[model samples]
Target: MVQGRIEKLRFIAEEMQIAFHLATNLTDPFFARTIARHILVRAENLIAHARGLRRPLRDAGFDTNAFHTAKEAYATEFEEYFKVARHKIGAHVQDFDFGKRIELWNDIEIVKLSYFVDGAREIYEGLAALTVPGYVPYAVPAELSDPKIVEILHQIQRSLDARTWVEMGTDSLAMARGNTSAVLNTTPVHARAGQLALIRRWIALQLELRGKLAAYPAIARLFKERIVTDIVSFCDCLVTRPVAADALQAMDGLNKLVQAENQSSAAIDDFVAASHFETDLAATRRVRDKIGAHLEIDEAETLPMLLADLNAFDLDKALAFYDRVAAAFNKQCFAVLFLRMYAADGARLYGVTMGHSAVKPFAGVAEPPPAAPPALPLINDEQEYAKNLRRWLDGDENQKGTARDFFWKAFMGSDSIEDIKETEHFGSGTRYHSHQFRKAHQFLLDALSDGLSDFDFKGVLDLVMSCRGGAPYPLSEVLVRCAPHAPVFRQYLICHVLGEIGSEPHESVSDFFDAQAHSPTWAVRLEAVMARYKSFIKNEGVFRTNHKGQTKVEHDALVASMTQAMSPDERLICLLGFASVHTGPLAGVFTTPFNSNYTALQAELEMLILPLLNDDDANSKVAMLKQLIQTHDYVGVSVHIAINLNSGENHPLYAALVDACCRGTIIAASNNQASRHLAISYVMKKDHRFAFEIAGPLADRNPDWIDAQILVAQILGEIVGAEADARKRVSSIRSAYKLSPMQEAALAAVETEVQNRVTRQEE
Candidate 1:
């Protein structure tokens, strides 16, 4: 009878445990409510059963001290609450009286219930406020309502069941099967191996899963559809076979350890009994045997069908199971290997623990330390290159070949001429051979004998161009070196190369130009003069600006470097280059148009160039104006010239210049040239009539040009009785374009000017 009562109590405890587990683990809110109700019912039942079992066990001559202790604790903590909960709320809900209910809101009507009053608290409070004579305000104790009550009941059941097991001789039977304290005759080496093997499998599974997860996105991006499909299939195969198989093998290894340890505990047994492991392992083996290990002809088991079968295997649950099992072994037996450590450290730890070297031995003596890389020769200076070349030519064939290989690798990054086309210094259209090296050698020998002549200059140029890879020696260094020795006519070729390459202009190149600028040959002198300005304009950072203005240090350094006295033509070229710096691509983006720094720089440059523009030489003035028209700076330079033209004398020249600047492209009126036109238009506002004449055509031709539209509208407002027309035109332009703050300011200025003009006329 006592045993039957104990069994009944155990059964109640197990039912409550199941309800509690379901309540916590199940995620559906509706199901959660159902499980919560079930847990309450089960908890009430367990309490009743435990209360009844105490007396029967005491009468059966069993020690009832633990039962008395549990009963006392229940009475002190949960007895009154459980009574009220069972009698008034849960089991006897029909017996409790509730006030007439009004339907305040329904779930469908309420968007969110949390926004309303706390229903449960209100119900309890209302119950407490009832005018019953002996009623005490009571809330269900947290302990009774909590799922943890089920755990307490389970512990009591376990204690009672353990005693019952002893009374029924089940403990002895388990002892007979295997003594818990018995030591194996030998260290369980095979069991340890199984443990390590399981760890290895786990590590492999983790690595495969992590690698595929990380690589799939990038692989999908970089590969074509067919290739991506194949790669995805490969990844799926890895996960389906190797990773899944590893999980299965890890389970088997864990089971082997349990068998080898010859000890059984509830935790380890619970892990072994988990049905998901068996289900998943069976599904995994089917995939491995049919699709992965062998491509079998089974229509019933397709790859997708087999893969879908694995959906039942929860990898997170499996990992938790393994961790639980390891913890159980650590507590019950000797310390087990830390599975996480093995998975994290990977094969390095495995090999070390297994007494194997981490590094695999090579088959032969390690390849002789790689031959030292060849150093680039110091040939930046022409004199240095000449000395090096003379020494190389004087050497025997082997030395000469070594020198050639060094130069070839330095210039082309490879000694073989087969890769010459691949070098950045060479173009696809140019075919080269090893013989070019020989020709270069002969040319250098000739040039060193008699300063480089026109005939041999081509060979030298080819060599210099081929070797211009921006290494220890670059095009700038080579040009500076070779400029002094290059023939007078070929100096222009060097200048052209320097300009084309766009490297930082070397000071020595400038000095060479200064010397050649006075050359007796007119063509040489002309080339030298132009090349000097070109080199200065192309120098790194010469024209680079931020939103502020030109980089002051670079601008100042460039100005200081202009030590050579300039002719009127040279000064014109400089002005053209400087003026265009602020008008390049996205001119307003890099430097604000007409910012103070830019205005100051312009004033400085105008002081130098305006006098030249007024030179008595008509041919020179015409030549300079034509040069400006042919370059990118034509609009900017012409605008500057037009704005600064003296009021009386050069008005015709200014008009002609503006006409030439605006001649070719109407699109320029709406684009980069718009800013320059806007500047000139603002200056011409002093003479509103002239401003209208200049800006009217542009505004009419490019109706979208906001600056021209604004200027024309402002000029019209300045004229008598055109106020309404100006207001209508300005409003239309403002509506059409999304004006920048500056453009908006210009529009605002136009309005202010129009208002002030009307005021002045009225006065």
Candidate 2:
């Protein structure tokens, strides 16, 4: 028979913990969607578990009053939080639709449903309030040191108030290093690596909070407000008379450092060249004022603002360049501080060099740059492009132009479409120009009507790269028409246009990748791999759905036209797509099989992929394994490794899987943990030492999971001889973990064994 109600509560707590880990740890939005759905399912299961516990607790309890009161309050509070989420968010109905409900208060509504920790905490609080024996379970430990970590973080902030910049920077760096000392002593390399990762996270936060903040308003604003005035004054002083000492320092620090090409004449020249400094300080100011510091301005507000101002690349480049400038300046300040610390004889050096007033900007500094020259166009090339575009748009001529001819002309006169789209105003030429590009888009599609036999594939790729804007098309019609063209060219169009194929009947992007990989040309095979990658990024490579269910007939026809051998890269990409699209454990009763119409195709692809696991090329195999790890495919990879193990094949693949497990590098969620445990069980019969390495990290992470704790205890007893220290470790687990009737009995059996071993050893 199953255990009592307390056991059920513990099981619910375990699920809640796993859900919280997956939701918080996995940061990628595409991967988080599946994790979020799993959390909601676990939350629903918790409600059922809570309800079942009430009847059992009342019948066995003498303290029913407190239990009853807490239950009623919790139920009332839960209904308020979960009313819309239970029906509208979790279900697809006519009036209360998931999409419509999400649009109302998107992040606020979704987070309440997805975050299980808060709900779990409320349940724990009520259980603690009850007075019945064993009814009030142990409080769950905070996820990796809650209040203590917060306290440590506050201490670090207090330390940041050091007098000088160097002192503050040194203190922050020391705290970052000191945080990882305990992780280094954990005894296992894998566990140490996982724990030490927090140091990098701490450093990244400091860089964002300390580094970026110091650079933005202080150094950036100063340069913007004073650079032109300082430079003009220095030039005027040089012509009319001699410069003052403060002016000389200002010119040496700001002007000479920025405009100097005499690399041998100064220390700053070498620093500037190595850092890739951009000389234009005025452009940097525009980006900061328009985008970073202000809120109300727009491209419409500043239409005559240079088109280059709107491109994100230009701003990003300018920001990066300014960061280097600030770092160089900050370094000079640190040097002065270091001199003052130890060199008593060099007090004069500090006094002369520490004149900060010269570098700092004043309120009166102001000037503007001279007017820029007008833009000129390639007249003949533009005329030809215009004629071809007009002809193709009007359907006036039977003569067709190549994508290369049209795209090359566009490139000479303009930047990438991304730059143009960002730079120009919607009311100005930007809107009209984007409309014209949409016409050019249709013209290119019409050019391919005759098929890709005469198409320069590279040229078409260049054109595809240039054609960017928010212009809608009938993508279903385009896909159907493009399907019969040359395999290479058709795959490129599919890769580029997959975003527009929403709810449209089309071939699976996977099928095209599998077919094109067999082509004689290497370029075609590379394009095929890239196309599958693009499709995976768009929506996990699932076939699109319509209101009338899947357009199954259209997809089947497209898959049936394939004939090619799969390259290694194609196999790797396809496996990644399959694993990402299919989640959950593979070992349980309700495991889902690969859902697809092409059974024979999938079987053939699997046959090709299995050999890769055993390849002699270590680099290639590791590369493939990295891709699997990145796509959250631990279960799928484990299943394949198990199949190979049964057949006594692929020794290298087995070694790789064991290394990954022992290193604790895989996603440490419930399904992934289950898969790793299963794999370790099979490996345990051969080598107990490797099994021990895997067991410690698993047990450490999942201290609340009774099964995991028991498993780790058993592994320790078998491999490490159940010494005094080992037995003590198991005893600690007994106290910390909430053991049920079954778990209590099982643990008692192990404890008896350990006691017998201790007596025999003493004798």
lDDT scores in order: 0.40, 0.39
Candidate 1: list runs displaced more than 4 Å. 1-469, 472-474, 480-485, 499-511, 520-564, 578-763
- Name model 2 segments beyond 4 Å from true: 1-543, 546-563, 567-580, 584-704, 710-731, 734-763
- Candidate 1 lowest-lDDT run of ten: 100-109
Error of 2 at 81 (Å): 33
Per-residue error at 213 for model 1, in Å?
54
Q: How many residue pairs clash in each candidate?
A: 0, 0
lDDT of 1 by residue, 348-413 (tens): 110011111121111112233325533445433455445545444556543444344444443433
Cα RMSD (Å) per model? 31.7, 32.4
